[model samples]
Every structure is written in C-alpha cells, then in structure tokens.
Target: MTRFDIPAPDAAAHAAALERLDALVKPVGALGRLEELAAWLCAASGQVPPPPIERPRVVVFAGDHGVSRLSAYPREVTAAMVRVFLAGKSGVNVLAREVGAGVRVLDIAVDDDLSDVPAEVRAWKVRRGSGSIEAEDALEPGEAARAFEAGRRVADAEVDDGADLLIPGDMGIGNTAVAAALVAAALGVPAEEVVGTGTGVDEAGRARKVAVVRAAVERAGERVSDPFELLTALGSACAAATAGFLVQGAVRGVPVVLDGVFSAAAAVVAAEIAPEAVRWWLAGHRSTEPSQAVALKALGLTPIVDLGLRLGEGSGAVQAIPTLRAARAIIADMGLLADLG
Candidate 1:
C-alpha cells in the first residue's frame, strides 16, 4: 500500500484570505457561497488568493456493476456513456468545453470491450465490472488495492502534467446503489434513508434497491475501520479508485471538486482513510440523492450549487467551474473598502 503523507491545508492562509475578503468593498458575506468558495481555494493551495485554474481536468472513471441488471436502466448504458464522454458529447464534455477545461475518460472497469478507445483517453482496466454486493464482495481478491492505486496514480499523473484542479466523475450503471450501501454502512444508517430513486426508478424498483442495499450491509458483517476493506467489501472498482484519487489529490496539494453521490461515497472512504484529505476537497454541487447530503455533511463540506442535480459523470462539478473561476476573480479584483474612499 502506498503511504499517503497528506497534510492538512494551512489554516493561516485561510484566515488571511478571510481577512482580505472582509476588507473587500462588498458587505460581509454578500457574495455568499462565492466567498466561502474563494476562501477554501486559498486554504487548499496555501495562497492568499489562489491561482486561477488554468488546467482543470475532469476524469470520468467508468465501470459497470453486477447489480446494474437489477436497476431500471440497461447494464450496457455504462459502456455507451464512456463512448459519449470520449466523443465529447456528454454533459460533462459540453460543460468542460464551455469552461475551458479538459475531459479524460477512463475505461477502468466498464463491461464493454473498449479496446477501440483512443490512446489519449484510455486507462488501465481493472476488470469488466464489479460483483454484486448483494451477494458477495464487489472486487476479486487483491483487486480492491489495485483499483485504489489506479485512482491515485491517475490523479498524480494529471497533476504532474500541470492539472491545477481535478474533478472526479463516475460512470457506472447502478453505481448509486453501491454508493448507497457504502454510505449506509459507513454512517450506520438505514438503507431506506440513504437510497434514492437512482436513474428515476419506479417505487417498486426503489424498494428493491433499498432492500438490496440493506442486505449487502448486513452480509458484509461488522463495518471495519480499514478503508480498503470497506471498499473491497462494499464499493465498486470505480468507487474504490475514486477514493484513491481523492486521497492522493490532497497528498499532492491539488484541490479536488467532487461530483454527486458516487463521488461523495468514495469521499467518505477517503476521509476514513485519511481525515486530513478532506481539507483539500470542495463539494461541486448537491445531488438530489439524500445519501449525497449525508456524505457531504460527514466531510464537512458545503456545496457550491443545489439545482437538484443527480446526474453523475462529473456534470454537476463541471457546471460549477465557471462559478469557481468567478470566485477567484472576485477575490483577486475586488477593490478594498478603504481604497474606495
């Protein structure tokens, strides 16, 4: 296991940024979430005014789940969406292009034979898809650790290539069900409270999903404090990989903006493994899923938007990038009140 010597973000820098923010011509908290967003950037990068994100990279880790067959959507949608992302036709691609950001799609565990994926976008495949947690562990033996490391390596390489900001997106049919199970087990909550109508399932489907999650949690035995074990037992390969990416983002001092419930569930595992990593994270948007809220609260993050978005594939996070850039502009260009005199 690669040891992550992640440090907490500098509190002094955050305080300094807040001090500067209070001196801006606008009234205190007038900018609302933007102020908080800017301050978080400062703290995250240890800069009084964080540098504008020049190379914002959105990486969608695509996988499949054995549980997808149980959901309303076809299991093949996961692979289909990977192709959409690669073609820059998905919501994430559209939003990234509009914000001057780049998108990379990873065929980490998609069930389709994505050998035709262009070299620039393809990543190592851990497997075709994870097992159904309703009956057994999601990953094969040793696969969990490998998935975790895959995520960390991808984040590290992106940062090495000068990516200033990272948005981890997910693409996997029935992933929300896996995420809901992880969240409920981690937080010791009931599945009914955490499970939502993923992909707009009908009431019967929703009830079935909830029951599946509850059974998975119960079958997993006692919740272990070890994050890797939790991931192997309850999370998809993409979820475990996402957790690894998030942990390494903080270790490398790069800020990470997390997308909806799947990302949030991975974040819960990341925080469990390294509590300090949470300091470098920002919630991009609030997903309509109740579990998303629970995961964010567990991480002590306030999301930048709340348009009831439940779309995964990093769409919600990518949509918030313009606002993030605007926040930077506000902190950097707003005149001081004293100067206004």
Candidate 2:
C-alpha cells in the first residue's frame, strides 16, 4: 500500500509539560493527572514539550477479514455487534460517557454492506470486505491505502470536534492474523509470537490461525524488516489506516490510548514509521496472549490494566480510559497538604 505522510504534532506539548510542572502546586512528581495531562498536551501540540489533553476522543474501527470466514464464528456476527455498539448498548459507550469522551464508530470494511447505516455511524467502507486471504493478498494495495486515509479522516474530524485524546478500537472478524502479521513484521519475530486467541478461538482453531499466518508471510515474498512493506504484504485495511492515524495523531500532538493487540500492533508499525510516535502512545491493557507481552516489550510500554481480558473490540481500552482520567484528575485537582496552610 502507498504510504501517506501525516506529520507529527506541531504544538509544543513538551514545553506545555514543562510549564505545567512549573505551575503544579506541589513539588515535582506530586500531581499525577496534572503531570500526565501536561506531558500529553505538550507532546500532542508538537511543542518542544507536550501539553495536557482537554478533551479525549474514542473511535472504533470495524471490518471483516477473509481468514475468519472459515472460523467457528459467522461473518454476520461482526455487523450485528457493530449495530449493538452504535445503539449505545455496548460497554465502551458506558465508559466513554463517564469521562465525557465523545465516541464515534466507523465502518472501515465489513464482509457485508451496511447501506442503511444510521446517521450516528460513520462509514468509510473500503469494500464489502477483504478477499479470501488463503487465495489472495487479502487487500489490494489501493484498498489498504484507502483504509489509512479513512482513519486519518476520522482523526481529523475528532480534532475538529475538540477531542484531544484519540482512542481506537477494531471490530473486524479474523483481524488477529492481520495484527500478528504486522507485529511479526515490525519486530522481526515469527508470526507465532504475535498470534493470540482472539474472540474465543479454541486450541485447534488457534493452531490453524497460526498456520494460516505463517503461510501468509511465506506468500508475501519480502523481508519482514521493512514494517511498511511488510504491512502492505500482511496488513489489513483497518490496521493500515490505524497505523497512519497513530502517526498522524502523534504528529498532531494528540495522545492515543492503544486498546489491544490490533491497536498495539498498529502502534508497533507507527513506531517503525516514526520511532518517536510511541512516546505519545499509552498502552491500555494486556491482551489475550503472551505475544502481547512481546509486542509491548518491543514498544517499551506498560499496561495500566492487567485483567486477563482479550475480548478485542476496543472494550479493554475503553474500560481503562476512566483510570487514565482519574490519574489526570488526581494530579490536576487534588489539594496538596501545603495548600492547607
């Protein structure tokens, strides 16, 4: 896929962090949220230092994969579940509202068409869905490029809508292979290191997923070291776009909370593109596999939540946003004992 350039955050987020530190009521490292927000804000704005986020935005990127069509789960389940989320019945809806974080769901690619999409949903449908990976490259180079543009467009909208933090969730079936491939490509690790039991894959199914991924890599016909090329060879539309968005968000001085394997893999790709991109990213949680540990270790990120939750769909990341908000509040609002004087 052709890569587009989304420059890093232009605001002085680092300087903002320094200024916030100077303004903090207590001694250094005394305020938590204030510190996080200050640093986040400064980095996002591309300031020599990053600054604090005034408003956070969460976007769910949904698609369908060719590999999972053969899995135990039916493809239709993806569309049905996405509808549930749009109706505000899902878990992230609840968590996002708690933090006053505006949430938007985008249909990036689905196996089935959602022509009658509700006014509330955003559709950047690349196609009905990706092709059968077993038979083809899964996504054409052009299609992958489109997905990246779609993600960047959404990020632009979120910025216009006054969201300082960008959180991404994926809703595609058979996405684990895409993530594992991307991670493997970024880290030079085998696909097995990145494959995890996503959406209830049994032991047998997990084995099959791994084999399919290994085959996908063999078919790619390129070295795994060049993350972008490997991405074009192994990445899904959602992953490609999300990678671009991550890069764009960092360049725009926006702080991103990466959800799970899919989101984290994209972060790995983002790091490959711009090593500094990972600095603006915060890992949300540990995912369903040990490979996630490998991926996070490669990124040098620590998850805030450690519950053995691997139910993708960005649920884990949304759940943790509240903790981050609390962290920010503790530093921003809590009174120091010295203030009592």
Candidate 1 C-alpha error for residue 214, in Å: 0.6
Q: Which ten residues in a row have the lowest lDDT in candidate 1?
A: 115-124
Lowest summed lDDT across 10 adjacent residues in model 2 is found at: 1-10
- State the lDDT at 341 in candidate 1: 48
**Candidate 2's residue-wise lDDT over 1-341, tens digit each?**
33434455435655655565655566777654446554554455555332344577778888788787545678887888778787887677777777677667777777666766774464477766676554567677667666777777778878777877888888777777778866765666776766777777788888887888777777775645665565657777778778777877766657788888888888887777678778778888888765667779999988878778777766677666666665555445655455565
Clashes of 1: 0
The residue ranges of model 1 lying beyond 4 angstroms of the native Cα positions read 1-3, 119-123
lDDT of 1 by residue, 138-256 (tens): 98878878988899999999999999999999999989899999899998889999999989998999899999999999988784456778888888889988998999999999989
Go through the candidates in order and give the C-alpha RMSD of each one to the true structure: 1.4, 3.7
Best by lDDT: 1
The TM-score measured for candidate 1 stands at 0.96
